[model samples]
Target: MMRWLITGGCGFMGSNFIRYWLKNHTEDYILNLDKLTYAGNPDNLKMIENHPHYRFVLGDITDPQAIESLVPEFDGIINFAAETHVDRSIAQPRDFILTDMVGTYNLLEAARFHQKKLIQISTDEVYGNCPSGQNTEQAPLLPGNPYSASKGGADLLCLAYHQTYKVDVMITRSCNCYGPYQYPEKLIPLFITNLLEGKKLPLYGDGSCIREWIYIQDYCSALDIVIQKGKTGEIYNISTGEGIPNLEVTRLILQEMGMSEDLIEMVDDRQGHDRRYSLDASQIRQLGWNPEYLFSMGLKETLQWYRHNENWWRKIKSGEYQQYYRQQYAQRHKKSTLER
Candidate 1:
């Protein structure tokens, strides 16, 4: 049996991967390690909590003792632990730098000591705003925000570790992921939950910015391939290859729910918003890992998940979300008012 460690296994992407891997890899076992932050909920993994092939440990990646002690217990490690919200990174750059960059360093050092095959799960934001041309694995990073910058730093850290210690490392920079179990703070979930609740939906900067979204399950599939067959010291881009404008996606979503554009509230745009993020993931595609979800089909399924899981989101929306969300959804929103 293949024993593995999954950091941030309860996060949106992590949980998706964990669920898929556990169900599909009957002979494999996983140990989920998570800090259970505001965005990470243990409820995501409740279904498989009792599975013989799965176990969980609550821990932070920054804790040296914890990471070192557990590094040797697994055949592979996928790091999904990150402070991922861009808007929050603007207000709390230090925190983003801490978890995304510093925390990765902790994981890398521990993995090196244990000679573990480490897959550093990263974001396309590390490549910064993609220019007119499609970005490949070699694109030079030009991150604009603390969030992207931190992820970029972490990518470089992985490269450094590979160069210095010769640690077996595989880095995967995936585009946006949306699917079940995602916290309601992200775009698809946030607006879906708001639209369901009859609250005004906030769009950042006319919502014209574009991003390529890979369904969470497809991303999990890609990661699974990378873990099992990827070469060490290689970078793989995982994306749908087409960037969709935020407004178009939002409008489509609202239209699907029988809502109108009139329900949208035009708030201020986000600071340093990247106009577009596109990736050329042909490298992964050529490796026999093709994505299986279409935009409309994936979106419909994701929308339906939120629709079906109202209780899961309603609980989150009633607290901090009640206060910070409407404005945080758009960078143009002034916190001074939300604070009141």
Candidate 2:
């Protein structure tokens, strides 16, 4: 059985990947290492916590010694650990640089020393805005925000390790992912959870900024394919090619929740927010991978999940979430109210 170490396995995409891996690749063994940041909710993988082939390690990738000790135990490493939220990055770029870039460097070193294959989970934002056409893996890196810049730096480090040390490494840059267990800080879940809590949805700017959406399950499937079949030292883009405007997405969520557009409260635009992001996922598709859920169907499924798991998110939104929400939106709310 192939043994793998999956970093950041408590976060949204990472946890989904763990569940997907355990379910589909029954013969493989997994070791999940996570620092359990605010977004890394253990409850996301509570269902499989006791599985025989799965193990969880509380640790940080930024610690070289920690990574060194674990590197020898696993045949491969899939790094999903990152400071992902754009707003959080803007507010605290230091954490983003330290985690996304420096942490990745430590992992790369461990992987190189152990001669283990490495897979870097990345985002399409590294290409900045694609106003005209979809970006291929060959596109130049032009990260707009601190979060994307950090990730871009990490991606470059991974490729450099492969080229310089012959360390087996592959990278997959994917579009926005949404589904169950996602932390509510992101747009879709934020809107869904806010509506559930009798709060208004915070719509940014004119809400014309566009993003491609991929269901979490489909994203996990694509990652699985890459881990098993992808060649080392290559980069792949994973996308469904479904670009939708932020306002339109918020409206869809409102519609799904049977709420009114009147609930939307337009807020100040985010700093350095990319206009649009698109990815040419044809490369990964060529490796016998395709998304199973359309945006509409996936979104409906997501809404249903939130409806059924109200208690799960309700508890989260009660404490720290309240403080974060106020800090992020209070000023924008004031401005919006004045304009109205």
> How well does each candidate superpose onto the true structure, as a TM-score?
0.93, 0.93
lDDT of 2 by residue, 1-340 (tens): 8988999998899999999999999999888888777777777887997788887777789999888988898899999999899999999899899999999999999989989999999999999988999999999999999999999999999999999999999999999999999989999999998998899988899999999999999999999899878999999999999999999999888888788899999999999889999999999999999999999999999999999998778757776544464244333322221010
Badly placed stretches (over 4 Å) of model 2 are 320-340
Pairs clashing in candidate 2?
Answer: none
Local accuracy of candidate 1 as per-residue lDDT tens digits, 61-126: 878887887777788788999999999999989878888888899989988888888889998988
Instruction: Name the lDDT of candidate 2.
Output: 0.89
The clash number for model 1 is 1
Determine the C-alpha RMSD for candidate 1 after optimal superposition of all C-alphas: 7.8
TM-score of model 1 (CA atoms)? 0.93
For candidate 2, which ten residues in a row score worst on lDDT? 331-340
